[model samples]
Every structure is written in C-alpha cells, then in structure tokens.
Target: MAKIKKGDLVQVITGAKQDRGGDRGKQGTVLEVLKDSDRVVVEGVNFVTKHTRVGQSARGSREGGIETVEAPIHISNVALVDPETKKPTRVGHRVEQVEKDGVTKTVRVRYAKKSGKDL
Candidate 1:
C-alpha cells in the first residue's frame, strides 16, 4: 500500500518558511501521484505559470495564453497530516482480518501512526 494516496491531505515539510513566500507548513490535498518520477502534485501548492502560443479556437475565440497550475514536488518533501492533531505524521500499515462470504481474509491497511487513526 502507498503511504500517500490521492485525496490525502499533506503538508510541506521541507522548504522555505511560509513567511518567506514558500509552501512549507502549508497543507493541501494530493491531486496526483507521479509514481514513475517519485513525485506528487499537491493542490494549491507549487504554483507555476505556463505560457502557450497564442491561437484562435474553432469558434474564433481567444485560445492560448498564460496559465498558472500546480507543479509536482518530490514525495519526500511532504508528510501526511494527522487527523487528530492536524499536524504532519508518518504512516504505518497493519494487517486486518475481515469475514467475506464466510471466509476470513487478511488485508493490509494504512494508518496514521501518530493518532492510531485508520487512513
């Protein structure tokens, strides 16, 4: 199981302080996970501007222009937020048993170690 998954709330643990115009300490939902690159894009974090060639749409309306979007950040730089404390915390996994169709099955589940809350 992945420690951090999409829709998980995460905080920037490494970066310039927020007072310095950085995202450190800021929390946001994980928008995407780039597994191949070991990176994750957090919503409202790491904003970057994109410039596209000016063009016309099929309806003759204005097309491309400058746009701002979130950029992917290294996964290590973020930590999962603890629901109880509203702070960053490490994730842990445990095996749980459940009865399905009269059969007991073991499943691996992720949880927040800080508050022992299931994730």
Candidate 2:
C-alpha cells in the first residue's frame, strides 16, 4: 500500500521556507503519484512555467502560451497531514480483519501516527 495516495492532503517537509518564496510548509492535495519515478504532483506546489507555441485549433481558437503548472516533487519531500492537529505526520500501517457476507478478510490500512487517525 502507498503511504501517499491521490487526494491525500500533504505538506512540503523540505526545501526553502515559505518566507523565502519557497513551497516548504505549504499544504495541498496530492494530485497524482508517479510510483515508478517516486514522485508526486501536489496541487498548488512545485509550479513550473511552460512556454507553448501559440496556435489555433480547428475551431479557430487561440491556444498555448506561458502557463504555470504544478510539477512533480520527490515523494520523500512531502508528509501526510494529520487530520486532527492539521500538521504533518508520519504514516503507519496496521492490518485488521473485517467480516462481510459471512467472510472475513484482512486489510492493511494506513493511519496517521500523530493523531492515530485513519488516512
């Protein structure tokens, strides 16, 4: 199971502080997870400017320009936010058994160690 998943709230744990115009301490939703590359794209974080060629679509609408978009950041640089305290916290997993339809199954679930709340 992944510690960080899409839609999870996370805070930048590394890099320059926000006072220095960096993203550190900034919290945002996890937009995407690049497992193979060990990177994650967080909303409103790690923004990069893209200069695209100006062109027109089939409908004759102008397209493409200098746009700032979120870029992927190393997964280690982010920490999941604890729902209770609203602070960054380490994740821990625990296995639990649940019965449904007369069947019991074991499932690994992630929770925040700080608040002991399920993630």
Candidate 3:
C-alpha cells in the first residue's frame, strides 16, 4: 500500500479542468479512500450535480432541483502536497529507525523530493 492516507493534503493532477488556465489545481484534505476501486474522495474536488425530488403534501413544493456536490476522483489523479513548499510533489518511501522499548525499529516513512523533507 502507498503512503497516501486520509487527512493528507493533495492536489488534483489529471482531471479535465484541473491545472487549467486561471484555474490551478485545487488542494484539499483526502476525505476518504476507496481502495477497492482505486479512487479517493477529496474534500472539495470533482463536484457533481445531485437531483432530489420534492415530496407530495409539502407546502410550496416546487419541482425538485439539482444540487451540486463534490464527487470522488481516482487516486492516480492526485498528487501529494509537500508540507514545506506547499506544492504538489511526488511521494517516496524510506526506512527510518525509531526507538521502542529501548530497541530501534525500522519503519517506512514517506518523504517529498521537491522540498527534500520528510512528510
């Protein structure tokens, strides 16, 4: 599994409108992980229209209208944002040692190459 996890900041990279003129890619927290489908739902990306029907016997119930809501995008479509530079950067993993019970344990850690910093 990759290091990309929920709450990590990410930028949309391969959508139709992403990184377009006057509309740079948006940055937001990863809301969910759809690992089975290889997709993720960002907090505020890939908006879609949702239509709801008005129930009968409701006062002033006009025809149902469509509401726009954020939708899920594929994980491959986003890049992790570097903490230091505040820009999107590729993710890489490295083994680091951590002290536990007076013993050093090696753990996989994610790092950002663009900023040369551990994330």
Candidate 4:
C-alpha cells in the first residue's frame, strides 16, 4: 500500500487541473486508494463528467445520470499535507521499537519530512 492513507489531506503537485489554476495548490481529503495502480482519488479533485442514462441503482441513488465525480490521480501527483506546517510534505518511514507485555517489537511509522510529525 502507498504511504498515503484514506482520509489524508493532500495537495496536488502536478496535473492538468493544477495547470488550469483550479486545484494546483488546493488540498483535499483522500477518498480512496488504488493500491494496484498506485493511484488515489481525492475529494473534490480531478472531477470528470459521467453521462449515464436515467436509472436507479440498488443503492437507491440514481445510477444513470450526468454526474461529476472525483477521478483517480497518480500518487506522484500529490503530497500529504503536514499538520504542523499546514503545507504539502513528503512521507518518510521510520522504524521504532515499542515495549509489549514481554518483549519489544519494531514497527514502521510514517511521518511528514517537513515537520517530522507522525501520520
């Protein structure tokens, strides 16, 4: 899985939307992650128009109709937002040891490079 997790706030670094001055420096929450393809869908980012015939789905929501939904953006195109600085930052992995009932174990933790805060 990618370092970025669902619900993480991320800002687009490079994309057509960024070039257009709409989502360039804007930050949004990650709705989903496509691990196999290393892609992520951010809330209110990379919107695409879908034209579907009028119909309802089992979910009760209309399945067929023109709707705009967030599209997947490559993982490299976005960076996680640092909570401390409130700016986009690269993710870094650090190993830490934790004491358990009998022994200590090593675990990997992700943090922002800029602020060095745990994610």
- Please name the candidate that would achieve the greatest lDDT relative to the true structure: 2
RMSD (Cα, Å) of candidate 3? 5.4
Across 1-119, the per-residue lDDT of candidate 3 in tens digits comes to 57579999998766455445321378899999988888888887877889988765557656677988778788887889988888788889888999989999989888977755422
Ranking of models by TM-score:
2, 1, 4, 3
lDDT of 2 by residue, 30-86 (tens): 999999999999999999999988787788977777999999999999999999899
Question: Quick one: how many clashes does candidate 1 have?
Answer: 0
Top-scoring candidate (TM-score): 2
**Model 4 clash pairs?**
none
lDDT of 1: 0.91
Residue 9 in candidate 4, Cα distance off native in Å: 1.0
TM-score of each: 0.87, 0.88, 0.74, 0.81
Error of 2 at 112 (Å): 0.5
Give the Å error, residue 63, model 3. Answer: 14
Tens-place lDDT digits, model 4, residues 32-91: 999989999999888899898876788886757688989898888888999888888888
Candidate 1: pairs in clash: none
Query: What clash count goes with each model?
Result: 0, 0, 0, 0
Kindly report which residue stretches of model 1 are placed more than 4 angstroms away from their true locations once superposed. Answer: 55-62, 115-119
**Scored by Cα lDDT, where does model 3 land?**
0.79
lDDT of each: 0.91, 0.92, 0.79, 0.84
Residue lDDT tens for model 1, 1-119: 68999999999999998899999989999999999999999999999999978777788867687999999999999999988888888989999998999999999998887745422
Q: Name the 10 consecutive residues with the lowest summed lDDT in model 4.
A: 15-24
